[model samples]
Target: GAGVSQSPRYKVAKRGQDVALRCDPISGHVSLFWYQQALGQGPEFLTYFQNEAQLDKSGLPSDRFFAERPEGSVSTLKIQRTQQEDSAVYLCASSGGHHSNQPQHFGDGTRLSIL
Candidate 1:
């Protein structure tokens, strides 16, 4: 089974460093989302996109975080001037679509460590 793929299973960066995370969703999936999960906590939504359109981003903590799906397939999440509080697992998920009832498939996620 071809599931979502995420790059850099782990990342270590110093405070104020910038990092970019990559996500490759299942082929043909139309809905994509980014989430952040802290220790002993459930994932919290950070952003959502339907195809090439980014429909929601209110969950982003600050202007330093940015996400995009330029081609409607591969997506990237970038964080600038990373802070210690930004340390967490960044997850990427994809589903069939808004009109479809397919459950979301998630990647292994990238654990970011801010020093």
Candidate 2:
């Protein structure tokens, strides 16, 4: 089966612009999650979706960040009004369990830079 994948592995955006990063989770997986990692820091939970239903989004940093999983398989993360502070690696992961303890397999991530 296919493993999780993300687009543009790297992105450079000007402040105030909007950017959308895509994630394709492993085939047949039931749960997906998004996380943000800044330099020298651990990944922070952003949002989660279970088969097209967003179960948790409490980790979203601000209103400028939005995510979705329309088909339960593929997901997208969109950031509005990009800022220098928004620069980071956006990782996506997938798991088979419903409980939060399920370990996730992560993609390399889309590194975004706001210049």
Candidate 3:
């Protein structure tokens, strides 16, 4: 079975530019998550989805961040007006169940750099 997959692998954006990152979770997995990992910092949860429903987005830093999973399989994270502070690796993970203890599978992530 395939693990989570993210596109672009790397991106460079000038300050104030908008960037969209994409993720494809493993087939049939019901729990999906998005995270941001700044340099030297552990990944921080950005948003979560159960199937096609976005259940939690409180971790998003500000209104500039948005995420969606329209069909419960493919998801997207859009960052508007990118800033240098937004430079980091965006990670995507998926799990088989919604339970708190369910182990998650992670993707390599798309690294974004804002100049």
Candidate 4:
């Protein structure tokens, strides 16, 4: 199968607007993770899912951010009422399936800019 495919590549949004970012992990991958990465910083975990079950979301910055993996294949990260602080590269990573502790494959990510 192909490697992880992170989508949109870029986005520009005004403060207080909403945005949705999509990610496609490797085919048949059993786990997905979403993160926010600021310039010069490592990716910050926002949420995670195993199949269609959201197993952890404690890292999400605020209530305005949401993530889902419905049907267990594709994942989406949504931000409501975007803020200037939300400007960053949103990343998706996946690892697992009959295995654990495998290295996660990262995507190119969507660069989000909030004006």
Candidate 5:
């Protein structure tokens, strides 16, 4: 019954620093995805995992961004050496499948602010 959740809801960091955001998806859901939403822009796919196996990560902008799901349940997104352009909302969603129209439930997201 637990829905997707992201921590901090907001994060502020100086350029060249690092930050980590957490996501907890609904219990029993096997599909999880991460997306980045810039101001006024649609959510862009960042990465996805199905039961601890990372199915895709082509959307990750740079090597500075990393994500992992060790136990097939919780996930973490870590951004290293943050830059001003990295400021955006980090969203997490979960669904019953890997399709684009699976009616994913979303967490509010952690809004990262790079200064």
Candidate 6:
């Protein structure tokens, strides 16, 4: 596929453990987004990146979450001190344009479970 790709299709973490999720967006994509989706709810934005710059991160639940796209390509999302409440599907998406109305391409999320 020519769209975004995410790794570790599934993850199980013990409470308090740290984990990292990876996302590889379509080549040349300029905008990237990370979202958290809980069961029975819609995906909630976690962060946004334009090229190599992190433009927004207000949606991140807490300081334990972090994301980066150092090379304006592959991105990584890290979560520390995982809690049961943190269990959710982490989604990654990318868009070819910078405009807010641009349609984003999404990757199958990494489902994380905290025990």
Candidate 4: segments with Cα more than 4 A from true spot: none
State how far residue 111 of model 5 sits from its true place (Å).
Answer: 0.5
Q: State each model's CA lDDT, in order.
A: 0.95, 0.94, 0.94, 0.92, 0.93, 0.95
Q: Answer with 1 or 2, whichever has the higher TM-score.
A: 1
**Model 4 over residues 1-115: C-alpha lDDT tens digits?**
5888987999999999999999999998898989899999999999988999999999999999999888999999999999999999999999878466778998889999999
True-structure RMSD, every candidate: 1.2, 1.1, 1.0, 1.0, 1.6, 0.9
Cα lDDT tens digits, model 3, 20-108, are 99999988889999999999999999999999999999999999999999988899999999999999999999999767757889999
Error of 3 at 113 (Å): 0.2
lDDT assessment of candidate 1: 0.95
Clash count in backbone of candidate 1? 0
Report the C-alpha lDDT of model 1 over 18-46, residue by residue, as the tens digit: 99999999998999999999999999999
TM-score between candidate 4 and the true structure = 0.96
TM-score of predicted structure 1: 0.96
Reference-based TM-score of each model: 0.96, 0.95, 0.95, 0.96, 0.94, 0.96
Q: Where is model 6 more than 4 Å wrong at Cα?
A: none
- Model 2: per-residue lDDT, tens digit, 40-107? 99999999999999999999999999999997888999999999999999999999866667889999
For 4-84, candidate 6 gives per-residue lDDT tens digits of: 899999999999999999999999889999999999999999999999999999999999999999999999999999999
Worst 10 residues of 3 by lDDT: 95-104
- Candidate 1 Cα misplacement greater than 4 A, ranges: 98-101
Give the clash total for candidate 3: 0
| Model 3: CA > 4 A from native | none
